[model samples]
Target chain A: MTGLLVGLGRASLSVFERLGRGHLFLLRILLGLAALVRRPRLLVVQVWSVGVQSLLIIVVAGTFVGMVLALQGYNTLITFGAEQSLGVVVAKSLLRELGPVIAALLFAGRAGSALTAEIGFMKATEQLSAMEMMAVDPVRRIVVPRFVAGIISMPLLAAIFTAVGVLGGHFCGVGLLGVDEGAFWSQMQAKVTLLDDVVNGVMIKSLAFGFVVSWIAVFEGYDAVPTSEGVSAATTRTVVHSSLAILALDFILTGLMFN
Target chain B: MKDPRLMEISVGAFVAIGLAALLLLALKVANLAQFSPPPGYEVKAYFDNIGGLQVRSPVKMGGVLVGRITNIGFDSKRFQAVVTLRISQIYNSIPADTAANIYTAGLLGEQYVGLEAGGDDTSLVAGDEITITQSAVVLEKIIQEFLYSKTTKSASPGS
Candidate 1:
């Protein structure tokens, strides 16, 4: 009994310690933002690596998801004689929930894992230490730009995801399914609101998810044990932890905003 | 080193497309234009029971949207519901004796106020009261009335 209690205590203590360290690391990166502003080119380069590279996957996934939503929604709505409302169902779901959440998940897997591996490899090669030896703040020179880039890329990607998804739904709903084209767009416009559903649901949710995912990726990379195996482990952890954070944060955010 | 110009151009393009997507989401998918309240006049109507009628419900004249319900209040003295509608400026010629009736859009759908115009030369202006207003039809009340009428008919036949 004593051994079990000791083990549990140690586990909880480590978790809290990691949480505290993560917050501090995030604060340091945020403080480093001022220095990053002086060299906007650094930000542009990171955005290219993170945002532009991830575009193809976001669009592909968005189209498939939107098409699937329309297909499934049509089947259900038809039973109740509401197939005409397919646009409402599809647009609302994509905008309010699936768009931000799925985009964040994909971002974690794509750009997030890349961030961890790149940073982790730098630590493994003593590149970070060498920067410190050269009188450079590694956090400002390295982590801040990527972190800010992640933050900027997420909302844009999510917005693109939602737009592509809406078109995909339209193709499936109006084109393939033969629902009236006019009704499809009109019902969607009448039902979904700008501030409540679009801004609050999609944009704000993506922004929050962006902050969480980027913070996790950078922190995990910075905290990784400096070895080849350690870099791999950190990369895996970045994807897993970031995915879990996106889902859990989505739930909390939905409760706060929608309620 | 890779071409910096190419990298910057790609990033700029990415940002541009993303902003365009957001703009499309706002204007095309969601109701952005409807957020701005149009130039309109307000009119009040009293009903016995509002039912599921809510503020922002469309007030239609002959199935055409002319205004929207702005506020729903309870009149303590008359024990009635007071619904205020903001009619657009273009629809300023609505007859003074227009009767407002609550109607459901579709089966198990949202309810709105439907106005039937009367043959009056004078038109309703801001703050004018619409006295001829019908309350929303509650499903349970309708079912109960139907059942009561059936029982009464059966009893009369027996007598």
Candidate 2:
């Protein structure tokens, strides 16, 4: 019993310590934002790596999700003779929930893991230490750009995901299933609003997810033990932790925005 | 990573595509244009009960949407629901004697204001009051009245 209590206390303390360190790391990156703006090339390169490279996966995943939603929604809606509302179901689901959440989950697995691996490798090779020796802040030179790139790329990727998802829903709903085209478009337009559904739901949610995911990735990388095994562990942790963070933040944001 | 120019081009394309997707969502899906009230005129109508009528509900003339409900308020003295409709600028030829009625779209659909035009030469301008109006039909009330009438008739004959 005494051993179990001691173990619990130690675990809790470590968790709190890591949380404090993560916040401090985020603050340091934010403090370097002004310097990062002057050299936009760094951001552009990171965005290319993060956003452009991830486009194909986002689009493909979005299409499949949307198509599946239409198929499932149709089967259910047709029972009540309200299949015309399939568009509303599909669009609202994508814009309000699935688009941001799923996209963020994907981003965590893809870009978040890659960022952790890259930064971990840099630390393992003493690249960050070399930058520190050269009178450059490693946080500013290395971390801030990748963090800012994640923030910028996430919303754009989510928006693209939603758009492609809507098209996929349309193809399954109207083209394949022979639902009325006018009813599909009109119902969606009537229900979904730019301010409430798009801006607040999709954009804001993605932005928050982006911030959380990037912060976790960079912090895990920076805090890792400088060894090959440690780098692998950090990469795995970045994906796991960020994915959990995205889901928790999504619930909170949804309640605040939708309610 | 090697080719900077190619990287820059791809990044720009990605950003452009993202913006384009947002535009499509705003226009094609959300229909942003519907939110912005067109240059138009406002008219008021009073109803006994608006039922499920809500602001931004489409205002139709002859089964065609020409405007939207701008506001809904209550007239305490008259004990009636006052609804304001904003007709689009292009549809300026609505007659002064138009009768506004609250109507449900389908069995379980949203309600809207439908205008039935009368043969009047004069056109309605801003803030014009439409005197002739029909309140929304309430299903519960109709059922209650029907049951009451049937019971009364049966009891009266027996008495």
Candidate 3:
């Protein structure tokens, strides 16, 4: 028991130390430089993988969550005679918390793991070493594009999720639940603000999460040994670290922004 | 060779489409107008407590939403909660004697401002203050009162 506790303590310390390193800042700078350098082909590949591939999942998940929120909120409010607040609950919860956080988690599961595995495989196969021998800056050529794509993609995806979620909530709350249609919309319009909280929170959280994901993927990839086992381990660690970082950062950002 | 430049172009197109979809969704949301309050007339109410009174909370008159709660604040001097409501222009002719009451719909349910129309012929104007009000009857207080009364009744009967 004592050994297990000590091991957990060491692991926690290592995670903090790794996070404190300038990897995230370096990633941001590399992404900026790549944007300036402008490799159109890499950008296109990223756009396909990050944006186009993600659409269907985001739409389906966002809509269902919204519907559930409406159904549950309406049922509870109806008992007390305040059923019209359904719109407010659905809109506020989606815009403020669900949209960005859920989208980021989904993206990490899909894209972050794939990114880590691809790079880890390249390292195991000595492809990265060959690139280094050829005087290529692997960070510039490999990490920067994916990092830039993640930052750009997350916010756009979050926005889509939020919009879809709100529509779904409206469908469930007013159409199915029989909330006064006018009352539902008017409450939404009055409460939901573009600049005040929703947009700002989404933008900041998405960007921070994107950085964490990309940084974890690259760090795990670079550290992988030249073995299949090493590659698998790196991929698993990347997903776990990135997802936890996204959740932790979410709480911190929410406290700072809302409090 | 699968030209990387072609891939980049395709990705850019995809991003543009995604953004367009979002814009379209935004427009759709904007167009789905249901409960918009009418312009020019506003009613303000005061409450002792407004639990679950969220921004965009509905303000109803006889089960019809006439307006929305646009703002909430505390009047430090009076030690009361002030709620600003924007009534629809159609309902501009509310009587000056209208009473606003904060009530809960259910246990652990949302709270809203319920407007009880007055019999007075004089109509309320914009920026009118609703002075006649009933504060929210909190569940805890009601439960405590009920329990206290029950205990006293049982004790007196036994004695």
How much of the true A–B contact set does each candidate keep? 0.98, 0.86, 0.33
How high is the DockQ of candidate 3?
0.25
Candidate 3 lDDT for residue B3: 72
Tell me, what's the RMSD of every candidate?
A: 1.5, 1.6, 5.6
Looking at model 2, the pairs that clash are none
Q: What is the iRMSD of the candidate numbered 2?
A: 0.5
When summed lDDT is taken over every stretch of 10 residues in candidate 1 chain A, the lowest stretch is A189-198
Candidate 2, A44-66: lDDT as tens digits = 99999899999999999999999
Q: Decide which is better by DockQ, 1 or 2.
A: 1
Give the Å shift of residue A139 in candidate 3. 2.1
Instruction: Choose the strongest candidate by lDDT.
Output: 2
**In order, what DockQ does each candidate have?**
0.90, 0.87, 0.25
Q: What is the Cα-based TM-score of model 3?
A: 0.69
Q: Per-residue lDDT of A1-259 in model 3, one digit per residue for the tens? A: 9999999999999878766654664754465564536675565576567666777788899899999999999889878787887877887787678888898888888888888888888888988889999987677777677767777888778877877888899899888878999878766665555544454656667778877777777677776766999989888988888889888989998898788
What would the per-residue lDDT of candidate 1 be over residues B74-117, giving only the tens digit for each residue? 99999999999999999999999999999998996789999999
**All models: lDDT?**
0.94, 0.94, 0.77
The prediction achieving the highest DockQ against the true structure is 1
lDDT of 3 at B12: 71
| Candidate 1 lDDT over residue span A87-141, tens digit each | 9999999999999999999999999999999999999999999999999999999
iRMS per model, in Å, is: 0.6, 0.5, 3.6
Instruction: Please list the residue runs of candidate 3 whose C-alpha ends up more than 4 Å from where it truly belongs after superposition.
Output: A1-37, A56-99, A124-136, A161-197, A200-202, A226-229, A254-259, B1-56, B70-83, B88-91, B103-109, B116-123, B138-159
Q: Candidate 1: list runs displaced more than 4 Å.
A: A1-6
